[model samples]
Target: MGNKNISMAVIRRLPKYYRYLADLLAKDIQRISSKELSEIIGFTASQIRQDLNNFGGFGQQGYGYNVEALHREIAKILGLDKKYKAILVGSGNLGQALTNYSGFKNAGFDIMAVFDANPRMIGLKIRDYEIMDSDLIESFVSENNVEIAILCIPKEGAQQVADRLVKSGIKGIWNFAPVDLDVPSSVIVESVNLTESLFTLSYLMKDGEEA
Candidate 1:
């Protein structure tokens, strides 16, 4: 099948591949042997060959692999080749922080638009983008070709916004609203509960940092 059907066990190895390739590329190393890669990534040489083989042939019997080529290949496999256009659905404190964060653009994501329900907040500029009312979400997404969205609205409005976003043709969602959402099989949603994460960390650190 495709990369989606790639098993989790194999998927876990992707970061290793990416990291080694990136490091080699930075050092201007044009090629790498599988044995060397295994030492760097802590995988067996056979495992490295098998992982690369599962995707496609990446090396030769005598020479080795082209480092730059492998880097480009892994990036494409992980959806980094094309920039992902996204929108922020809440335009609140957290949403505005995301808007101000310039780092996502470097990682192949661009927050092109933002939405809110309040009239006073709508049409105001935050960072480089202006906040638009959620009423125009469908048209905005269609016009801008936005494929992903980040939800930071209240828990009550979370599902409501998700429903609108599903109908708006968004392919993926990043939800921070403390609610489990229901979407189509075709759409992907990643939940990140910051409150819960901090609380969990606090409990683990209750005895004063890990020894």
Candidate 2:
């Protein structure tokens, strides 16, 4: 099956595979059987096989999988091989934290600029980037050919900022605004709702206690 046909559940599991494989590689592990991978990743051997098969089975029947090869493949699949020019709006606590994160840059998402509406926050620096006026976002995005936007603004203004980003040719958004964004099908939005995730953890803990 083609990538579009792959289920989200399987796609979600791919990152885990990539991380564990990276860990194995770091430990000087060369190859691992499906059963061994399952034990480490907490997925059943059959499930791991099925998941990898969706992206073309990378493992040999008896030889299992080459850790380095699998890690490289997964990185390519996740688009980590290419660099993306990104702009961050909302340079408050969350936005500043995201800007300070070096991991995104290492993974090919380079945050080129940071923007803020607050006059107090404007002209501030996060890492090497000096916070710019939100008014300049559209121009900056259009001029620089920005591919992605990281939204850490409030929910009330998130949609407005998103509209501006979409109009300026942004293809993807990493939204931390807590509200679901309304964007075109051509534009992909990956949202992170911290409260919702925390609530999920709380639910699981409560369920375990009741059980």
Candidate 3:
């Protein structure tokens, strides 16, 4: 099946599967049955099977799945095998924390540079990268062939920055700003709203209390 035909729910679960498979590999586990994966991953065995089937079932009916091979396949499916040149558009607390995270680099997303509108933050070092002025973003992205952008700025300027990113050939955006961005259909955007997520958790807790 083509990726477009896959449900977003299945696509989101791919990362969880990849992570658990990697954990199993580290434990020196070799092969795993769908039921076995279900126990650890908290999904029903049938659900696991169906999810995997979306991208061509890799598990054998009797022999189950080879842990190493499954992990590699999931990595490729998630595009983790390819390297992405990315840039960060904010250098505030959240932005700095993201820069400090080594996981992004390990997963093939290299943050080539950081940009910020604040005058004080300009020229400041976040690890090896010195923060550049936001005005230079378009040129920098075009010149460096950046494919992804991580936006950690406030909602006020998020859309403006997104526009600049799209103009400069950014294919994907990992957005942390609370506001939704308006961009071309060809440009992919994944947004994380901390307040909204926390609010969801709060609502669930309230419902549990009322129940």
Ranking by lDDT: 3, 2, 1
**Residue by residue across 144-210, what tens digits does model 2's lDDT show?**
9999999999999999999999999999999999899999999999999999999999999999999
Tens-digit lDDT track of model 1 for 136-184: 9888887877899999899998988888888878899999999999998
Where does model 2 exceed 4 Å of error? none
Which residues of candidate 3, in runs, are more than 4 Å off? none
TM per candidate comes to: 0.79, 0.97, 0.99
lDDT digits (tens) for residues 109-184 of candidate 3: 9999999999999999999999999999999999999999999999999999999999999999999999999999
Measured by lDDT, the strongest candidate is: 3
Which candidate has the highest TM-score of all?
3
Ranking by TM-score: 3, 2, 1
Candidate 1 weakest lDDT stretch, 10 residues: 202-211
Residue-level lDDT for 122 in candidate 2: 85
Report the alpha-carbon TM-score of model 3 versus the true structure: 0.99
List the global CA lDDT of all models: 0.88, 0.93, 0.96
Error of 2 at 178 (Å): 1.1
